[model samples]
Target chain A: MSSFVERRLSSPVKVAWLVALTWVGCVYALGLVHQPDVAGDASGGFWALVIALWVVATLSVAGLAGLKLRSKPGRLAVDLLTPFLFGAFLFFLWEVIVVGFGVPPALMPPPSAIWERILVSTDLLWADFRQTFLKGVLAGYAIGCLSGFAVAILADRVPFLRRGLLPVGNFVAALPIIGIAPIMVMWFGFDWQSKAAVVVVMTFFPMLVNVVAGLEEASRMERDLMRSYAAGYWETLIKLRLPAALPFVFNALKINSTLALIGAIVAEFFGTPIVGMGFRISAEAARLGLDMVWAVIAMAAVAGSAFYGLVALVERAATFWHPSIRK
Target chain B: MSTTSIPLVGAARPGLLGKLWRGNVGPVLVVVAAIMVVWYVAAVAMNWQGVSERFARMGQDASAGAVFWQTMAEDRPMLPVPHQILVELHKTVLDVAPTSRRSLVYHATETISATLVGFLMGSALGVLLAVGIVHLRTLQKSLMPWVISSQTVPILAIAPIIVVVLGSIGLRGLIPKAIISAYLCFFPVTIGMVKGLEAPDRMQRDLMRTYSASTAEIFWKLRLPASLPYLFASLKVAIAISLVGAIVAELPTGAQAGLGARLLAGSYYGQTIQIWSALVVAAACAALLVVAVGLLEKAVMKAMGGRP
Candidate 1:
C-alpha cells in the first residue's frame, strides 16, 4: 500500500486520476446525505463537501494539463476534452445542486429540465427563428452591410465627405442605438420590418467606419507603385486597396452579424406580431416559464454562433493572403 | 502615393478664416448644415400627411409654405425636424427643473451612474479572469472557448431572463442592469487583456525568468505595463457597450428612470421629438464617456512613461 501510494504521487497522470476519484467519491458521499430544502439552509457538511470538490477538481484538471501527452493525437484529444469535460461537469454539478436542494424550477431550472424543455419546444423555437433570424436579422444584415460598403466607397472617393462624416458617424454609432427600436416599431409598425430597421441602424456605422479605415490601409509605397503603373483611381482602388481592406471589412461583418441579431431581438421587445425570440423571452419570463426561456436562449446561442462562424469562414477564405490567416 | 498632398503642418502661418477652412471643424460644420437641410426637407415630406389631416379636421386652407413651417414646428411631428428635436432637448435638459422626472438631465444621470458602475465591475472581472487564465494552463484551455461561446448568445435574449430572475432574487433596478452591462463589457476586455498580457516577446519573458523573478513579479513588472495600451483600448469599448447594456436593461424592465425609459415613454405617446432628444442626449453622453476614457488613457500612459 505504501509503495502504490508513492508510485501514484510520483506520476502526474496517476495523481490526476487519484484526485478525480476522490472528488467523485466525495460527491457520492454527499449524495447519500440529506440535503437542505433551501440553498440558504445548506448544512456545514454540504458546504465543506462543495469546497472540497472544487479543490479536488481544480487539482485534477491542473494535473491532467501538466501531464504533457507526447503523441500529437493524444495532445489534441486532451486539448479538446478539457473544455468539453469541464462544461459537462459544470452542468452536472448545477443539475445536482438544484435538484438536491429542491430549488424551484421557476427560479433556476436544472439542466435536465432545460434539456426537456428544448426537446419539446422545437416548433416554437423554429417559428421564433424564422421570425427573428430569417426575416429580420438576415434582411437587415444584408442591407446594412451592402449600403455601408457602398457608402464607404463613395466616401473614399470624396475626401471632403470622409473628413466631414466620419466624426458624426462615429458619434451616431456610439449612441444607445437600441433605443431606436421602439421608434422604429412605431414607424414601421409591430413587425419584422421594424426589427430590420433597428438592425440596419445598429450595424450601419460600424461597417462604414471599418470600411473607410480599410480603404486607407494600403501604405504610401504600395500606392506609389500603383501610380507608377499609371493606374486610374478606380483601377488602383479595385486591385490594391480593396484587397488590402478585406480583413477590416470582415471585422465589421463579424461584428455586424452579432449586432444585427441582437438589434432584431431587442426590437421585438417593444411590440411585435407574436412570434420572435425577444418577444418569447420577455413573455415567457413574465409567466415564469424559466425552462422555456432557457430553451429560447439555447436557440439564440446556436444561431448566433452559427452566424458568426459563417462570417469567419468566409473571412478566412477571402483574406487568405492576410498575415492573420496565413499558415 | 503623394505624401506631399498631406496638408502642411500647423504653426503661426495662417489667418483665422484660412485656418478654419483647413481644419476639421469647418468641414464638419458644412456637413452638419447640409444634413440639417436634408432633414428639414424630409421632416416636411413625412409630417405633411398628419399635419394636413389635422388642418383638414380644422377646416382650414393651408399653403405648402405654411404646411412646411407647420410640420417643422409641430408639437409631435411624425419625423421630428432638427429644430424640433433641438427645442425638445432644450426643454428637457435645460428649461425643466433638474429634479423634475421629465428632465432629460435626471434620466441621463441615472443612466450614467448605472453605466459607470457596470463598466467598473465588468472591467475588474475581465482583468481578474484574464489574469487567472494566463496563469493557469488548464483554465486557458477550458474557459477560453466557453468565454468565446458566451458572447455568441444575444444579450437581448438573456437580458429579460436575467432581469426577471435577478428581480425574483430581490436584486432590483441598478444591480440587474449593472450585471447585464458587465456581461456585455467583459468579453472585449478579456480578449484584449489576454492578448495584452501575452504581448511581451519570448526574449523579454526569458530575461525576466533569468532574473529569478516570481510569477507575480514578472506579471506586475513586465506584463501589466505592456498590457496598458491594449487594456485602455478595450476599456473604451467596454465602457461604450456597458452604456448600451444599461439602456437595454432599462428597456425590458419598463423602468421609468433611465434614458431607455424616456425612449419607451416617447414611443408610447408617439412623441417623436422626445425620442429624438433622448437619442441626442444618449449620443452626447457616449461621446463624452469615450473622450473621458481617452483622457484617462493619456494620463495613465504619461505616468507610465509611455507615449500618449
Candidate 2:
C-alpha cells in the first residue's frame, strides 16, 4: 500500500485525479453551507469542516500544479487548469463567505448579484461602452498617437528639439495628467469631447517618448546601409527604422490603451453626460446603489481588457518578426 | 540616449555658454520658455472672445490691442495666462497660512500624506507578495495570471466605489484615499519585485547552496540586494501613481482639504486660475515624490557597493 501511494504521487495523472477529487469534495462541502437553512447561521463545527475541506482542496491543487508533467500537452493543460481552478476557487470563496455570512449588498455584493446586475443592465452598459470606449477613447487614441508619431519624426530630424522635448515628455508623462480633465470639461463642455481631449493629452507624451526611443532603435550599421543605398529619410523611416520601432511603438500602444480608458472615465467624473460609465458610477455610488456601481465597474473592466487585448493582438500581428513576439 | 550627448554643432567652443549648451539645463530652459510663449499666446486667443464680449457689453469700442490686454487679465479667463496662474499660486501657496484650508500648502500636505501612506503600504505588500510568488511554485502559477490581468482592468474606475463603500463603513478621510492609492501602486511593485526576486541566476543560487546557505540567507543577502535597483525603479513609478490615486480619491469625497477637492471646487466655481494653481501644486508634489524615491534609490545603491 505504501509503494502504491508512492507511485500515485510520482504520476502526474494520478496527482491530477487526486486534485479533482479534493475539489469535488470541496464543492460538496460548499453546497452544505450554501443551503437556505444553513446559510448565515452554520454551526461552528460545520464551518470548520467546510473550511478544512477547502484547505485540503487548495493544497491538492497546489500539489497538482507542482507536479512536473513531461508531455507538452500535459504541461499546457496544467498551466491552463491551475489558474482557472484558483480563480474558480476564489469566486467560490467569495460567494460562500458573502452569502453564508449574510453580508449586506451595500457593503459587498456577492459575485452572483453582480452577474445578475450585468445581465439585467445590458442596454445601459452598451450605451456607456459606446459613449466612453467607442467615442472618447478611440477618437482620442487615434489623434494622440498620430500626432505624437508625427512630432517624434519632426524632433528626430531636429536634434535640438529632440533634446529639449524628451525630458519634457518624460516629465509630463509622470504628472497627474488627469488633473487637466476639469479644464478640458470647461473648454469643451460637459460631454464626450472633454473626455476625449483629456485622453489626448494623457496619451500624447507616452507615445512621443516611445516613438523617439523607437526611432533610435535602428543601429548605425543599418542606417549606413540605408545611406549606401541612397535611401531618403522617409524611405528609411518607412522601410527600416519604422519596422524596427514596431516593438516600442506597440509598447506605447498597449500602455495608451489602458491610459485612454482611464483618462476618459476619470474625465467624466469631473463632468459628463448622464449616459457614460463614469457618470453612472459616481452617481450610483452617491445614491448608495453599489450593485449598479459594481455593475458599471465590471463593464469598465471588461471593456478596458478587451481594448488592451485588441491592441496586443494587433501588436503581435505587426511585430511578429521582433524577438519578443517570436519567442 | 545619444541625443543627450549631442553637442550643439556651432556652439562647441570652450566657455560657460558652450558648457551650458552641452548640458540639459539650457535646452530644458529653452523648451520651457517656448511653452510659456505658446501658453501666453493661446491664453490671449482663447480669452479674446470673452474679453470682447465684456467690452461690447460695456458699450466701449475697444481697440484690438486693448482687447488683447484685457484677455490677459480677465476674471475668469478661458485659459489663464502663465503670470496669472503664477500670481494665483503666490496668493494661495505663500501668502496664506500653511494651516489654513485656503492654503495650497495645506491641501498639498493632505494629498501627500495620503499618497505616502498608501505608497508605503502598497509597496510593502507588493514586495511580500513577490517574495511569496517566487518561493512558492503554487503561488507563481496561481497568482501571476491574475496580477497581469488586474492591470488590464482600469482599476482607477472603481476609486469612487472604494471611497464611498469604505466611508459607509466609517473608515473615512485619509485611509480610504490611501487604499485607492495603494491599489493603483501595488501592481507595478508586484511586477517589478517578482522580476527582481527572480533575478539571481542558477550559478549564484548553486554557489549559495554549496556554501550551505539556507533559503532565508540567500533571500536576505543575494535576492534582496539584487532586487533593490528594480524595486527603486518601480518605486519611482509607484509613488507618482500613488499621488494620482490620492488626488482622484479626494474627488469623490468633496472634502475641502486635498488638492483634488481644490480642483473640484475650482471647476464648479469657474475659477480657472485656482484650478491651474492646484494643478501646478499637484504636479510639484508628484515631481518631488518621484525625485525623493530616485534619491533614496541612489543612496541605497551606493551603500550596497553598487555603482549608482
Candidate 3:
C-alpha cells in the first residue's frame, strides 16, 4: 500500500468543523440579544437558551472534528464519538427549533421534556408494554404465524384449496385493521386478548401468502430429485422445501413482526382497560401532555426495534444461505 | 403463446361459466356455503342459551340467527349487518338526504376527500425519502435500519404526541393526518425503493457511465425505470398504510369528521351498527384505493413497453 495508514478525515468531518465555527458565531450574537429584564417567562427566553446550548454544541462538535482530524487510532476514536455527538446535535436541534420557533409543546414536545417523562414514568410505561407487547403482540404473532404456516402447508397439499383460499385471503387482507379492530374488541372484550386477535388477523394472511409462495421456492428439479429418492410429500417438504423457503418465510416473519406491533397498538385504540400505548397516547394527547406522549413513543420505538432486531437475528441464523443475508 | 391462447380458449367455449365454476367458483362457493352453514348451525345451537335469555326478558323470542342479523343491522357505524350496510350504502349513494348527519353519502365524501389528500402527501414523502436513501449509500446504511426501527414505535403511541405537537403549533386538520400518514407510508417506500433502485446490474451502471451521463440522468433513465416493480409493490402497501394513518390521526384530535371520527362517534354512543357501517365504508374505500393503484400500475407498466 502507498500510504493506507495515513488517511485524511472525511469531507463530512471538515464540514462539521466549518459548521461548528459558524454556529459558535451565531450563538455568541444571539447571547448578546438576550436581555434578562425583557425575557418573557419560559416562552420569552427560549431563544437565548437555544443560543447558549448552541455554544456548548459547537465546542462538542469541534472537539469531535479535531479528534477525527488526527491519524489512525485517534481518528477511530472520533468515528465512535461522531454518532453520539450527532445524536446529541439532533436532540439539540429539535429542542431549539421547536422552542425558538415557539412550537406548541402539545404537538412536538422538546426532547428534554420527553426524557423527563421517561425518567418519571417507568412503571406506567412498563405496564403498557406488558399489555401491548408481551401479551398481545407476542401471543398473536406466534399463533398467527404458526397458523399461517400450517394452513399454507395444507393448502399446498390440496391444490384446489390453494386456488379457493388465496383470493379470499386476499379479501381478508383488504379489510382494513381499523374496520375489524372494534368488532374484535366487542367479541373478545376490552383486554390484551382483543388486541391479540386483531394482530392474529392482521398477520395471518401475509404469512399465509408468503409461506404459500415460499413453499413453491423449491425448484422443479429439486423436487424431482427428492421424488427420485422415494421421499414422501412431508419428507420432501421438511428436508428440501423448508430449507429453500427459509428466506421467504423469514421475509414474512419480519413483515409480520411490524404488522403485529401495529395491529396490537391500533386495536387498543378501539377499546382497552386503559393501560396501553394506544390508550396512553390517546389520553395524553387529550390532556396535552405532549412530553409524556413522546416518552411513550420512545419506549414503543425501542421495544419495536429490539423485537425487529431479534427477528432479524433469527432470520440470519435460519437463512444463512440467503444472498441478502450474506451481504 | 400458451398464455395468449389460454383465455382465448375460455372465450371460444360455450357454457364457459359452468366450466369455470366447476374448477374454480364451485369450490370457493362450497367452502363459503359450508362455513355459513356451520355458523348458522352453531348460532342456532348457542342462541338457546345466552342472547336468547336476554331477548326473552325483552319479550322477544327470536331465533339465534335472527338475533345475529338484527344485532348486525342495529350495530352503528362500524359493525353494521352486511345487509344493513348495503342498504345504508344505497341510501348514501342515492343521496336521499342532503342535510342529515345520518346520511352515509355525506360522511363518506368528507372522509374520502381527506384520506386521498393525506395519502398523496404521504406517498410523495415516502418516494422522496427512498430516493435520498438509495442515492446515498451512507444514508442507506445508517437510515435504513433506523427507518425500519421507527415502525416498531407504535403509531398509536406517537399519534397523540404528533397531534398535540402540531395542535400546539397551530397546525390542524389535514396537516396532522398527512403527517401521520407519511409516518406510516414512508417506511415501506424507503425500503422498497432502496431495493428497487439497486436492482440494476453493475453492467447497466457501467454502460450509463460510458454515455458520459450525470448521476441525475442515470438515476432518471436507469435507476428509476428499474425501480418500477418495487415502487408499485410499495405503493400498494403505502396507500393502505396511509389510510390507516389518516384514521389514527383522527383519533387523537377528536376531529368531528373523517372515518376515524365517525368510528369514535359511534363507539362513544355505542351505535354498533353505525360503527359497522362506517367500517364497511372505510374497507370499501381502502379496497377501491388499492384497486385504483393497481390500475395505475397497469397503465404505467404498459407505457413502459411491457405487458401488464
Chain A TM-score, structure 1: 0.86
Q: Sorted by lDDT, highest first, which candidate order results?
A: 2, 1, 3
- Can you write out model 2's per-residue Cα lDDT over A159-184, one digit (the tens) per residue? 77888899999999999999999999
The residue-by-residue lDDT of candidate 1 on B1-308, one tens digit each, is 24435767875777897677666777788989999899888888988998888887898777677777788788877788877788788888889998899899999999899899999999999999999888877788878988987877786678888888899999988888899899899999999999999999999999999999998999999999999889999998899899999888888778879998888888888888888899889888998999999999999989888863
TM-score of 1: 0.91
Candidate 1 off by > 4 Å: A1-56, A70-73, B1-15
Worst 10 residues of 3 chain A by lDDT: A1-10
lDDT tens per residue, model 3, B48-131: 354556677899857767666554333232333346656766765566674467676666666666667777776787778888
**Which window of 10 residues has the lowest lDDT sum in candidate 3 chain B?**
B1-10
TM-scores of the first chain across all predictions? 0.86, 0.93, 0.78
> Rank order by TM-score, top first?
2, 1, 3
Question: Would you list the C-alpha lDDT of every candidate in the order shown?
Answer: 0.85, 0.88, 0.73
DockQ-based CAPRI category assigned to the predicted complex of candidate 1: medium
Question: How big is the positional error of residue B278 in model 2, measured in Å on the Cα after superposition?
Answer: 0.3
Instruction: Give the runs in model 3 whose Cα sits over 4 Å from its true position.
Output: A1-87, A99-104, B1-51, B58-81
Please, what are the lDDT tens digits per residue for candidate 2 over residues B152-232? 898998999899889888998899999999999999999999899889999999999999999899999899998988898
Off by over 4 Å in 2: A1-10, A26-34, B1-12
Q: Which residue pairs collide in model 1, if any?
A: none
Q: Could you tell me which residue pairs clash in candidate 2?
A: none
